[model samples]
Target: MNNLTPERRKGRKYDQVLEGARQAFLQDGFDGAGVDDIARNAGVSKATLYSYFPDKRLLFIEIARLECKRQGDEAKSIMPQNLPVRDMLSFIATRMVSFFNSSLSLSIFRLCVAEAERFPDLAQEFYRNGPLMAQTKLGAYLREATERGELNVEHPEFAANQFAELCKAGIFARLAFGVDKRISPQESSFVAAEAVEMFLARYGVTQD
Candidate 1:
């Protein structure tokens, strides 16, 4: 769902270029990753690389979009639907925290923010594919839980956003700004548990 033309996307080297670009962007960030390096890493000539992805920005954004989709799908596949509501919420929160603190995630967020003004479309695409997609998925789960009498959420969308922000609480900003080098498992667990508690306090169904 990127800007790649149909003919360009049909070429055999398309996936090769994308994989190479993914590695380069992850290691060097958007501005630091050179086209020559990307082509070399892909084992393709510059002409072939350019034929598939004419713009580096499009290549970067496409990688981010694909990564987001892959993560979303993985989460859906691994998350147990039969778990108790509290356990399920905790699982979601813990996973969210872990992903937020990942190096790849941090790099993508920094790149999107740094180049947002110059490449507004890049940032917008990342947002839609990343945060917006996550929120939508969470909202759907909240609605399902509410139907099952597990949560008393009136507005699933707002509650989903709140839960996501809560997952990020203390750790995300620190990591994003380079204030904290890394988040320990203990810290990550604490944040995830606390997020679940706070969210349940607000939205969980209370027995009379």
Candidate 2:
């Protein structure tokens, strides 16, 4: 008799719609995918899809957000820093770059950008999920390292942004242009090691 309990099933419908919508966008890209296709895939009617999402663009954007959130969750689960902060940072950055290089991450970004103007809402939502989450979470980690006397940071948020830029330097841009086939093993190590050096020079303080 409890309406709001798990047995009540308040968000199952929306969850199903989002799952189907994400799968469709990933498989077909936003432009190539259709609302009816998503509806049918979810076993829901177009009317139901409309009720769940105001429009196809919104649905695609939501899917992008969901995927970004899932990645954020994974990143947060990384082991906390006990070593030199630079080493920890390198570990996280290397893992992050490899994660982004995956085909699925590249495809969602391409899909979002290709239709960004047509659906500014989608673009904005994607920003919240990707850049915003990445910076905030990584910044928190850096802030913690500073409190532990492992690194000295003036602004953890800015530190996080710079660290990410270093790791991603020219990598995503190259991906955007289809100039490379993902960051190779050698390249990833080079980037990670160099970024660690850069981060330490900027944030680590030498003993007096």
Candidate 3:
């Protein structure tokens, strides 16, 4: 379980600690980041940092949660709802692929998996905030589109998961496994386009 409580989060240095810890984790990974370095980066003393986060794992989990929330909020704010189904799906696929290909996202995923056994809640929190959140949002849109006669999806949640996997088809595995250091724009675009097409082929409404 996470050690961070609502009361602890109310501390003035909470955000500062989190930001500093995020940088350290990004640079040195979970095991490599030290409490002293994190405190120094945040311009706070070790005691101040420890007061907010009793365990380093709790700090990492909180960072992941907040980052996921930020990304999810940004996606919701900018995603256009008035576009045609194909266009909307294309937009979603592109965004998903880009996020999946990012170094920070990959690192978070790797860390979650690596710590799953010892810290199962960490992986659960990541899933709830990341993949499950995306799926739920996409499912709602798909359901609305289906009601508007723009799509034929019977199971929007399942379809959303499928489309997400399709968007990850080529670049995700390669990057996650170190087969590729970076995903070129062309590769990401191609994957997104293909995912949109394949998804539309299955669920798009036919017009005579």
The whole-model lDDT of each prediction reads: 0.83, 0.73, 0.85
For 51-127, candidate 3 gives per-residue lDDT tens digits of 89988877877777777778777867887869999899999999999888876677779878987787677677778
Candidate 2: list runs displaced more than 4 Å.
1-63, 79-81
| C-alpha positional error of residue 24 in candidate 2 after TM-score superposition, expressed in Å | 10
lDDT per residue, candidate 2, 116-208, as tens digits? 776565556567767788789878888887887878997999988898888887687886667875678888888778888888898887867
Candidate 1 TM-score versus the reference: 0.74
Candidate of highest TM-score:
3
Off by over 4 Å in 1: 1-59
What's model 2's overall lDDT? 0.73
Q: How would you order the candidates by lDDT, starting with the best?
A: 3, 1, 2
Model 2 Cα displacement at 49 (Å)?
15
Off by over 4 Å in 3: 1-14, 21-59
The TM-score between candidate 2 and the true structure equals 0.66
Winner on TM-score between 2 and 3 is 3
Best by lDDT: 3
